[model samples]
Every structure is written in C-alpha cells, then in structure tokens.
Target: MRIKQISVSGLFGIFDHVIPLNMDERITIIHGPNGFGKTAILRILNSFFNSQYSELRAIPFKHFCLGFDDNTSIEIIKNTDNSEEAEKNNIVFKFYQPYSEPVYFYLKPRKIRSDRGFPMMFLDYGIEERHTPIIRSLDIRTEETLFSEEAVEHFNNLSFPNLKSQEEPNWLEQLQSNIHIRLIESQRLLNFVPNRSSRRSAETPSILSTVSAYSDELAKLMQDKFKEYGTISQSLDRTFPVRVVKQQPSTDLTDEQLRHQLNELEATRSRLIEVGLLDKDEDAEFQIQPQDIDESTKNALSVYVQDVEKKLSVFAEIASKIDLLRKIINNKFAYSYKEINFSKEKGFVVTTSYGSSLSNSKTLLPTDLSSGEQHELVLLYELLFKVQPNSLVLIDEPELSLHVGWQVQFLKDLQDITQLADLNILMATHSPDIIQDRWDLTVELKGPHK
Candidate 1:
C-alpha cells in the first residue's frame, strides 16, 4: 500500500505535523537545509519495515501512525527494555482495516545478536557476493523434511496458528517471507561501496565491510596490467573461457535489448551459483506447487496470484546485476565498462569500450576509478540491484561529491531504476542541479518537518 501521508507527533523533534506523501510520482525529492530532520523521516520509515524502533524508544509518544492511501494504517505499540519481561519488547504491529477492526499479531523478537539465527540476508553491492543472513533459527520444512507427519504439524502450528485445516494457505507467512528489500540510502551507501574497503572505511563507521576485486590479491595484477593497457582484458582473461555481453545501455532500450539484459543476468546467476560463490542455490527450483484447494477458492485466488506473478516476472535471480550492467553502460565515465565477463579463476570482470567495441575496449580495476566515479557506481549499483517492487527507498544528499553533470543526470537515472522495478524514492538533497525542473514533486522541509 502506498503511504498517502505521514502523521507524526512526539517522535524525535517532529512535532505535530502531517506531511503528505507523493503517491502519484515515482520519485519524491525533499530539499531543505541541514538539520531539517530529513534523515529522521527516513529513519522512522525504515524502522517500521524493520522489527525494532530503538530510536523511537527515546521519545515517549502516545501515538504515531503511518496512514496509507487505502485508509489503513499501522500503529506502533512500543515496549521498552525496562519492562519486567525481557522478551516482552515484542512487535505489536497493529494493522487497521478501513471500517473494520484492527488485526493484531505478535512476532517475538529473538534474543542475542542479529546474526545468530538464519533469517533474511542483506545484499552487498561492491562487485562481490555477500550473504549476511539475519540470525534467527526458523522452523523451515523442506520437501525432504515434510515426509514426517510430526514435522508437518509443527510447521503448520508455527506458520498458521488459526488455520488447522489442510486446504488453507499460510497467507501471513507468505507475506512475511517475501518481504520487500529494505531502505537503501544512496547517501549512506558509503558503507557498501568499493571505497568502503579502503583504509578510510575502517576508520569510519561502516555498516557493511565492502569487499571488491581490488581488495583481494588481484589488485596487484590489475594494477600491473592496466598501468599501460587500462583495460580488463588481462584481469578477466586468466582462463580459456570468457562470456562477452555486447548490449550497451541506451536512452531507451528495445525489446531485443531487454531480452539481452535478462539473458545476461540469468547467465551470470547460473555461473555464479555454479562456481559455488552464490548462496541462492539452496532455494527451490521452479515447480507447480501442488495445493489442496476447493474450486471456489481456486477461482477466487487465480487472478491475484497471476497479478503477483506478472509483477515478479521483472525480477530475475540477478535483477540487481542487470541494473548494475545498465548503470555501467549508461554512465559514460562509469569505469567505461562496455561488456562484462566471468571466469571461474578470475570471477566477475569488466572490459571498457568507452562507446567502442569490446575488442578495442580498455580495462581498469574498481580501485583505478576516482572517488566520485566510485560513488556514482556504488550508489546506482546498490539502488537498482537491491531495490524490490513497491519498495520505498530513502536517499539523503544524492549530490554528495558528485559532478554538476552527474547531479543533473541523477534524476532521470533514478526514474529509470524506479520504472524498471516499480518502486518509490524519497530523496533529500540540497543541490539545485539534482532538482533541475522537477519542482512539482519537491517537499520543502523547514526544520521540525514544518
């Protein structure tokens, strides 16, 4: 559901205010001076998608609700650590239906660090794969494990509390399992960029320890080879086999272009998983899941499932990788990456054409690029690669360290990404270049969200 407006009071410094959200536009820009609490808005929004509100706990607000366009809203019921029960700091997420009673459910927060139990995994965008799954041991029943009647009953008890019948689907569990990708802020993406792997990143507070091709032993090899050649041919040609992608990003890609992109992404995922670098190999393969359903229920749910499938079709296993490739090809100075290749020995590598053919293209390591260039690559890569359909992305200060020309192109590129994924972005920036002519979608935040 689209957030039509945000109603806040007593949370942080956001006094009594109702900021209307832009449900019409794909991109929403918030322009204001520093200390205007632009980042605070993003933080609170992100905290909802996440199970915790540690930041909001500081404010003893009586009520704070995120009202949706559907007249539905989620009210946050807070529980502090000082409570008598340690596990009482649970998620009391109340979902109110228009003209109907609220649906109350509790997802018990697991104790210990966030990494002890296998939950969800966060994707890293620094040219390497990192599956840092949230720690929470779940009672997962695979087809192999479902043979036991006891295991089947246990799975039902955990996933579907009320629905004891075999015919009903665990709709709640399905919704929880396919949760959209969380907020990825371009401004705070320093924690995920290749530059984050540098010494500077260690000195600063990094959310994710970014790992790139340059951080490994291959940096020396790339430097030595590209010192004169300035191309990826040497670094990627270590093995006998290398797949070359010829399609480059255009202002508007044709049907053939899209097919090539989809195919390239599909191949990369296959090769990456085949070489044991990807963790998604554990996921179940395509199959018509047998469901015990009555004809009435089947007919009613057929249209809904079809709609969901149609929307999901845009997302292949490597949608983000496809986005990265698009960004690399679209941005002229984005390391001149014209074609991408993969080698079992070399891993994923790139060749630069600078608008020429791959054979004549130059190559450079991820470290060879300037900080500004790296920032552009990292920001675009993460947004496109990590965002999911109907996802809400919050970006702060997108013009940070970017060139004037890049700042101008930023809006269009962002729109392209959103269009491809059907997501909404709320970006806070101070640069006029970033705004350009898109003033209609701008939200002016004069401190305290007035």
Candidate 2:
C-alpha cells in the first residue's frame, strides 16, 4: 500500500497543489521552506489514509484524490449537495456539519466493481472536543451518512494480496476487518512528532509510569488485557494509602458508566450535579463536605470512589509493560545487558552492567547516561520494539535532540532498520544534515500557492 500521489485544495493557507510521489525508495523525505505546508502534507495524508475527515468539517473542497500503487484512488469532494457527477465517482468521506453533538463518520459503502471506492477502518477517531458520542463498532447508517455493515464484511471477505516481506514503520495498528485497508497511520514516530504519548514516553523513566501515561493521553478507556495481568493488582489498597482523586464542583460522578448516566440528566436544580441516574449528587461529599452533606450523599461518593479506583488500576497495568530498558540494552543499544535491577529499598534505582568484558561492568541509573545515549535508547527502542512492519511512519522532525553528526547519521540508521523490517518513512525535516544526499527522495512543498 504505497501512496503514489495526492492533491489538495479549498483549505486555509494551501492553494492548489499536487504531490506526485516517487515511493521507489524505502525511505522518503519531504522538505520545504519554513511555511511551505510540509507538515500540512503529512497531516493531509495521515487523515486521508485513516478515513478521518474531522479536519475537513464545514470546509469546501474542489478536489482531493489519493493515488495508490494499484492505479486505484480514494477521492474526497466536500459539500457535494448530492451532486450526481460527484456521486458517479462516489464520495468515500464526509463530515457532520457545524461539528455539533453526535459527530459522524459518513462512509458511503457501496457494492461496485474495482477502482471505484476505498475501504476504511480507524483505530482512533479524534472526537474528544465533541464529548464523544459512543457509537457501535460496526457500520453507522444515517440518512446523510449511510453504509451497510454487510457490505463492509463482504469487502473484507474478499481475497487480499499477500503481504510483502519487507520492513516497515513500527506504528502499524492491527485492526480486524473484511476490507483490505492494511496500512497503518500514527502521529507518533520516535518522539519526533511530539504528540501527547511521545512526550509521556520520553519523560517517564519506569515502565509503569510510561504505560499509565500512554493510556491516559490516548484515553483508550475500555481495554481488558490488564485484567489478566496482576503486576498492578488490588493488593496496593493496603500497601498504599487511600488518596482521593481530585474533584471539581462541576464533576459529580466517578464511575464511567455513571458519567453517561449524568450526561442524560437534565442540567436543572431539580436537581443534579453528577454522573448517576439516581436522584442524588454522587460527589456530594467533595462538593458539600462533611458537615454540609447528608449521609446518603457521602455514601454515594464512597461507592463512586471505589469504582474509580478499579478503573484506574487499568492504567497501572498498561504502565507495567513500558519498561524496555532491559529490552533496549539487549537489542538496539551498543551496550549489552549483563544484568539490570530496580530496588525499592535502594530508593528505586536502575543499575545496569554493560561492556565487552564481564568484569568491565558499570552500574548507573538512567540519569547517569548521557543525553545522547538516553535519547538514542528511547527513540530507537520505540522504532524497533513499538512499531509494526508496513506502517506508514510520519516523523515531524527527526533532529530534535541530536548533534549535527548524529543528524547526519539519522537517515542511515533509519535506513538500516527499515531494510531489516519492511518499513516506509516520510519525515518533515528542517535540518540539512538529515536531507543531504537524499535529494532524489525529497519533495519540497512550495509555500502559499504551489
């Protein structure tokens, strides 16, 4: 799944533009002047491939076509007003007008021949601003936005092309489907694209902290794998003191299920200020306090806090999986992992031994490592361990923490890894060191008009 070309129009700062890509190289680079929409091109491709049109809401579009290696295309023409001509090609994407309640993904799934339409399944749909109206995992069919779940199943049920054995970018997410939209899109690549998750992964030293940060930032609230893992179990209830979750007067419910119940409640003083369908303020204790609130309200708050604790443990379980220091030292790091241990009695110190000879061992915390070594370990570890092959990796800027010499070798290191695993990299870089000698693969997005 290679993108051969893309053209965009009818958005701010971007005039008519078309990018005819040469994806023959395993590594592709996009370079342009300061304000030349280099990042915009990456964003456009990211949204297009993921079937996310939230960015295109209420905006008029002249033409947007995504060309593929198979000579097939996925087109987007906004504000169609039911035009018969545009309908001939079929609009694969649409957005809810005004960005109001119940934000929608209007995919016009159809039963047709080859090269006419595209199949899409998304891992993350950015709708947090709309408060997220939870919809079923299956197809959504409305008057303006309609599609049959059956059609989608039939599409994916078709034969898929055999996957190539080449290496790919590591952020590919595996989604179950009948359709063949196998390529993955992620906003994170080596902390270069400093989205919420990247910053968390970089700052958090231990695996437990890192996983918690990932889950919290992404808010993947309903994962169940944590239940099977006891590394973050309820035994902490006695070991750790009960700490109250911070509360706002505006927030009245602690249960996630109860939050939905609160949303359905009318904002009336009749009265309600919480997440429960029950006619009581679940957070009455936090809101009204010991002397002011009644017994029933305090009890409700107690029950709510317990539910919150159970839900929060899910985050702890996720954090437990993030400790890859040992894995990194074993794999990508220049040093070999002789032995590494964390001691609570020693004030939670990470000690590692690395060198050619066993007696040449050195013990040091992550803080003891140089900035370059730390950055290289974390970023390259994510590239090798966190990513899945055949992923379309997008890096905002690959030189954020490196020396000029390191910047020059960045592309070479990326190429080495990409070759080992079938991967594709499209990076937006300002540093010339990273772009030198890669002119054939570079596409400079001219600013303002081009």
Candidate 3:
C-alpha cells in the first residue's frame, strides 16, 4: 500500500513535525551529507512498525536508567489511500503511542540494577535515580494511535494485537499473517523504490496465501488419505489367515513355529521323493535340515521371502508417487527473481541475467558472475522482476558499486519498477544523479534537527 504522509513526534533527535506528502510523487529521495538524520529516518520507519514503545525509548534512555536522569519517547503518523478508498471518499492510517493503550506490541528493556556492596539484581521495569518505578507514560491506545478498524485490526493481529480474550483464535498465528496494508502516503520515495522482498511487508497476501494455503490443504489431504489407507490395510491384515509380518522390536518368532514349518516342508519333499516327483537326487541333498534351523524354519523362510518382496514393491511404488507429487507442486510455484549460470569445469566462467529465459533455464546467484554483472543482475531483479505495487522500500545507498553512466538508466528502471509494483521508495544517497528527478520528496537531513 502507498503511504500518503508520515509525521514523527518526540522521537529521538526529531522534533515534533508533520511531513506532508504529494500523491503525484512516488519516489522520495533523502539527500544530504553524512551525519544528517538519514539513517535515523530508516530507523524510524522500522520502529513505526516493528519496535515496541519501551524498546524504542531504551537506547536513548540507557544513561538515564543508569542514574543520569533522562527520558525519551516516539510517536508516528502514517496516512494511506487507494483507488477503493478514493471511490469511497475515505482515508485510512495508523499512529503509535508508548504505553497504556492497546499497542500491537510491547517490549520492555532488561534493566540491571547494581547497588554498592549489594548483590546484583534486575529491575522489572525502568527505575528512577532514587530507584522508584518510572512507569512508562506512553499511551499506545487512543491518544497515540488511530487507524481504520479493519486496517488496524489486521495490523494488530500481525503485530502486538491483543490476547485479552482467550476465546478468539489469534488470527495472526492462525494464518501466519504478518503484513499491514496502507495506501500511498506520499509520492516522495516512489522513484527510489526498488523491487525487492525487503521493501515488502508481511501483509503481502499473494506471497503467503499461495504457498501456505496450499501447504495447509496438502497436509489435511495427506492426513485423510493416510487414515483411509491405514483403515483398509488394517482390515486386510485382520482378514488374512497366513499373513506374514516383518520382525518387530517387541515381537519375536517362536522356534516351535519354525520347527513345525520346517517339518512340513521336509514332509512335502519326502512325499515327493517317494512319489518320484523330484527331477534330481541332488535336490534331496538340499532338503530342509531342522537341526540347523533356529527360530525360522524352511516354511517361515519361504513366507518371509514372499512378504519382503511384496513390501519392497509397495514401498518403491509409494516412493515414486511421492517424488512425482512433490515435483508437480514445486513446478507450480517455484518462482525465482533472477537466474545465473556458471560453468565449474571451464575455469569459473559465469553468465547473469534477469527473467526465466525462453528456454526456461534455472536462475543463478549473482556472485557467480563478475562484479558489474552481479550488480546488474541485482538491478534486474529490483527493477523488472520483484517490486510490488503500493509497498514501501527504504534504501541506505543506491549508488554503491555501479558505474556513473548507469546511474540515470538505473534510476529510470527503478522508477519504472515502482510504477509496475505501485511502490513507494525512500532512498538515502550521496549521489546527485539519483536526486535530479525526485526533488520534491528529497528531505535534507539537517543534522540534530537544528
């Protein structure tokens, strides 16, 4: 989903400010010299979704926790809208608070308290210089947050949703859902947005629903098939009078059964011998020897041979069927972003490209090729192969390990990919080339908010 606006307040080093966004701009380019809050913006994005209020504050409050009194907090506002929302004349978004509200998450810092000459002890929560409870004042419920009920509920389930009512199945855990949806908040980062899994969130339904849903169904079907097959097998085992079974750890063959079987075989041979059914006298020498037989007799041996052959055939057939089924499933959904082909026997030669070729050759890793080829391969995946629409991507630096001449083309391709995926990209870069077009979204990281 696209983000329309992002406002950060009380976050470390960032003053209370609202960053308005334009819908026409999709790529947001944040350009400034190093040591500006460029990296901090990335951190804030991560914190907006991933960090707990207490954990968010802990880094800035470490010294304070150690008796040098200090306190810190963060709040974020995200706005989103889509075609559907536009038609409905409605907008949706989310906000976060530190505590006392139904925060989709809660992460408290581990506090270690060491008093002079006293045994080391750990505090359950933040403590003041006088060793009193600090009682985190962040309210994550109403004041610090807002979002559409449906959207917020979806995110809450994936994130720090509630566990108050045991009756409701935890939707997040049930479906293994992890993504939260939002509309484009601003057009700033649209151009810089690259196509990659890193830019996507867990709310991506196609990614999980396709494979995970199939897996769940497959497991249920297999379980049912096994049950039906086992029921029939059990009935067959009970109906058979002379059924032979493999030796089991708990059960042993009796010598009596073996001896009796051996006698029966010998008796049959002796009768044949008397009747002159035997073709050769040499065959008589191969007669069953009861004295040499232990728990298994000649008759048991014959049964075992027949049983083993039948079991081996059954297992071989089952194995073949299973392998075929697995192959079919893999072929159905095994999508790769890019492919590389390298020859090990030919002095480490390498070839890299994007897309499953017309020949449908397997995709290869980037490292198999030269450095430039590898970067291009990555670019191919980012531009034409993987980026999704209405997603957010944060890039630390887009210009590393690439030629200067390719910068424009790379950005152009990146912009095209964002359009394809309907994505919003936030990039932090030192190069002026990447910033030429995304001037409106470019935020100068004025160091320390001065």
Best by TM-score: 1
lDDT order of candidates, top first: 1, 2, 3
| Segments of candidate 3 deviating more than 4 angstroms | 9-18, 51-107, 111-365, 368-373, 379-388, 448-450
Ranked by lDDT, the better of candidates 1 and 3 is 1
- Writing each residue's lDDT as its tens digit, candidate 2 over 1-450 gives 566776777545355567776576656677767666666666655544443333343234555666667554545665455776655444343222233432222334234344323343211111233433211112223212212332322222221122111122222221111112222222222221112221112131222333223223322221232332223444534433343234323344444544443332223212211111112443232232234334334445444445444534453422332233333333433333534322212211334555556676766654455455555544554554355676656777767656786787777777766665456777778888998787887776665633
- How well does candidate 1 match the true structure, expressed as C-alpha RMSD? 17.6
Note the clash tally of each candidate: 8, 15, 39
TM-score of each: 0.51, 0.43, 0.36
lDDT of 3 by residue, 1-450 (tens): 234555444334343333433447567776676655455555445433332222233222111100000111222222123465342322112122235342231222212222222221111122245543222111223222211232222222223333111122242232112322222211212122111222222221222312223223333443444354445445644643454444332235455665575575555444433322222352343355657654444444655433323322332322332333333223322332332221212211223334646565444322333344334434333332233445566666667655665555556666655665566676677888766665776766553444
Candidate with the larger lDDT of 2 and 3? 2
lDDT of 3 at 412: 68
- Per-residue error for 437 in candidate 2, Å, reads 1.3
Candidate 1 structure quality by residue, lDDT tens digits, 176-247:
334342555554323432122312122222244232432232334323432323232234333212222222
- Give the distance in Å from residue 6's predicted Cα in candidate 3 to where it truly belongs: 2.3
- How well does model 1 score by local distance difference test? 0.50
